[model samples]
Target chain A: METPLIRLVNVHKRFGNKTVLRGISLDIMEGKTTAIIGKSGEGKSVLLKHIIGLMQPNGGEILYREKPIKEMSREETRVFRNKMSYMFQGCALFDSLNIFENIALPLKEGTQLSPSEIKKMVGERLRQLDLEGTENQYPSQISGGMMKRVAMARALVTNPELVLFDEPTTGLDPIRKNAVHSMIASYQKELGFTALVVSHEIPDIFHIAQNIIMLDEGQIVFSGSSEEIQTCETPVVRQFLRGEAGSMFID
Target chain B: MTMHESPTQGSGILHSLGAIVLYRIQLAGHFTLFLAAGFYHIFSWPIQIRKILQQVYFIGAKSLLVIFLTALFTGMVLGLQGYYSLVSFGSEAFLGSAVALTLIRELGPVLTAIMVAARAGSAMTAEIGILRISEQVDALKTMNIHPVRYLFSPRLAAAIISIPLLASVFNVVGIIGGYLTGSKLLGVNPGVYFLRVESSILLSDVTGGLLKSLVFSIVVATVCCYQGYFTHRRKNSFGSKSVGLSTTSAVVQSSVLILITDYILTSILL
Candidate 1:
């Protein structure tokens, strides 16, 4: 068996008196797309945050390539963080920065690239995202789909080995959503990078994920291949995939 | 748990102590870097003079009325207090020196900084803190441009340089107010008062106050920025309460630091 690129060992998290995650364990394979599907508030984004080292699990550990994320020192974390990119759910582009500057930021800070080299690299990424002409526009100046693309371009400008995406299609129209999904698929395939995508858009992720994990109330209720999920006889998975209200959810 | 300890009680105390030490170190480091970055921005002149002129209109020119009113009352009070003290010593003729020294060397910078902290510094903290909580800071961080370099350097630079200049204006106007109050209302000799002031006051007194103002600027900017910058989470975690707390802390912390530093500088310089 291949060594998993990302691993969570009995991860747990809580907020004050309420438990948000409870001993969740999973392995994400290298260079494959993994989709985490769940209801709106079932620790999906929380799991993404754990992988990116944005939040620490209250108990247990999260590992990237056998290295525990919490054990890394500040400088080590900076280096580790540079190797992975996160596309936030809201496409959190800097409102103060134009598209070109936003995409070029990580390269300019993390690499020894000259200004012209950084410009060229940013231009290439923009071209890849079909955002070549919108380089000078601010985040607020663009549509949500274009903003998502800009964020993706920024994330990929450094050519990270792992990408964590939170609801990449969440506020876009269906057409734009499909466009973003296709772009994510193409980028993963072209770069051979590991992707952990969090979303409720089941059909789009069904086309993209090599493996699927279903989270319910902070626990991994189902874990299998996309085909396995399709064939599973569980009422929760079937109802979720069919868009029906099930007993798994209230109301 | 120890005999004296409730569950997790000692741990909380230890953490609070550690946090205090950590915050002190962070504040010192932040203020040092802030000062250096501010000087660099000032010397580099990255921002155009037109913008500075515009800010002066807002930060300095618009603040003139308040500064004047506050200074006038402050100087008048100082003069009244000085006359009584000087009469006790049979040196009421030294009233000009008393008013000038107090206004120029102490109250001028400290009071001006407190006012600016109340007016401008709180607004700055609120604006930047809201921007931070809204994911703007994360956006800047991901862009690879140091938010400190882009966002903080200019404001810190402007505050350090401008606050002292504003204080000087306040001092000069305050001394003139004192002279009017002392010589016109109190029947003191203007020539005697002016002569005593000219002989008694030194350039070092004004320098001490300006230096204090510079320190005040660094304290205000660093505390405001650090509190805002560190408290933001790139999600739905940030809100108006954090901004409000940060602004209030900036004003209070900066005011206290200004007062403490004023005493220290006075003792050292005088």
Candidate 2:
């Protein structure tokens, strides 16, 4: 009933001659967990990038709290950026910075928080992610799973309203993947913030998401509740769900 | 390449010369604006001091050992060469002038710049390129920090200050090396050589070389940083190879530009 927290209206993105997103339209409700499941190179990441204004759409607009993001001033865009968190596919932590500094960066740079305050908050996030006692270590010193958690911690440090997760469980072992999923679920549950997760891990997506959106060839093939997704007879949806040997997604 | 006497050849040479002049004018215009920005930051006191110190660490302290070693050996080699050449002319007393003129007018700053290009320039290009590829530069922008103000302008200011000082040091060290070679190794009277050098060389030659050093410092800093920072294809597509290409190109472009500018400035000033 309430207006969506974020919305993409007929968005189009093209790379050279190839069109990646052709009139993509989606509305992300406030305080909801929405999982975007699609095959590789289906513009799932492109959709997330548009929301953050990292890549502007060639056609149409992205709205944050019903305001057009496309026409926002540079200062407004920066302010908007700080209000959302993005976990890059590879964890994207600065190699030169230690975990403590990495987690503390947004708060230190964007906020007027004192050093002690930042330290206290970073410590809490580290403990939440079960990454305690590794503050002084560089990103290179940690395992991939831990680096993901570190990135998650940094993303959460700013207390963003919207968090974008790009394939959070792709590289993790099953146990670690489950661990990441649970932490993500818990964080969203407790914070009551909107999350837009892009992933191909169908089981994990179904387990964590209340809502599901399926992307194919840069267009939304299906959008519904998780239960609706499970029962949908759409060929693409069925193929993705079954993890079939050969499907329309094959080529 | 034989020097062919043809009207078309003359036109081609004129065209290339015209293109080079135009490029140099553009470079000078951009360089002037860069220098003006640096000059503005100079009055900010502590912030400027902090920036200057950081750059000094990068451009001066890090470059000391290479500049010194290069200068010393280059001086020694020049000394040996000059002594033998002077002996053939029966003007062995002119050995000091020969070494001094070579080091002051050409080799010292040019050699230092080449060394900096190979060492600092490549390193800077690779580091910035990696940052660019990794989206760290994007991250900085997202935080509303200007990459130029935060990362590059400081290095440019530091290079301006450090390169000229290093060039002076190189000239001194090289002259010392030449003196040692002349007196101890080549059996030339050091007094005659010093006298000839002091009488022949003027303040203008030293000034001209120092001027070149200042210009070369800017060339090295701007070309390297610009190449890395401006490299844009798309996200994730850029990697180490782009950085490597930019690094090599920066060095080659900066070196060739320095040589050409050196000739033009020398002709005008001297």
Best by DockQ: 2
Worst 10 residues of 1 chain A by lDDT: A242-251
Question: Candidate 2 chain B: worst 10 consecutive residues by lDDT?
Answer: B38-47
TM-score of chain A of each: 0.96, 0.96
* Predicted candidate 2 versus true structure: per-residue lDDT over A109-189, tens digit per residue: 667789999999999999999999999999989999999899889878778889999898889998999998898899999
Residue A81 CA error for candidate 2 (Å)?
Answer: 1.8
TM-score of each: 0.76, 0.84
> For residues B1-270, could you state the per-residue lDDT of candidate 2 as single tens digits?
445667778999999999999987986787567556645555533355676797789888899999999999999899888888888989888888888889999998798887887788877777777888887776665444456665677777888888988998999899888988987898888788788778878898899889989988987887777767755542434577777777787789888878887888778876
Residue-level error in angstroms, candidate 1, position A6: 1.8
lDDT of 1 by residue, B136-211 (tens): 6655554434566656666666676678888988888887777777888886799998897788788888788889
Name the runs in model 1 displaced over 4 angstroms: A73-75, A248-251, B1-96, B138-197, B230-238, B256-270
| lDDT per model vs. reference | 0.81, 0.83
Model 1, span A160-221: residue lDDT tens: 88998889999889899999899999999998888999988977898999999999888998
Quote the lDDT for A35 in model 1.
Answer: 97
DockQ for every model, please: 0.26, 0.33
Model 2 bad stretches (over 4 Å): A249-251, B1-55, B87-91, B139-150, B191-203, B230-238
Backbone collision count in every prediction? 1, 0
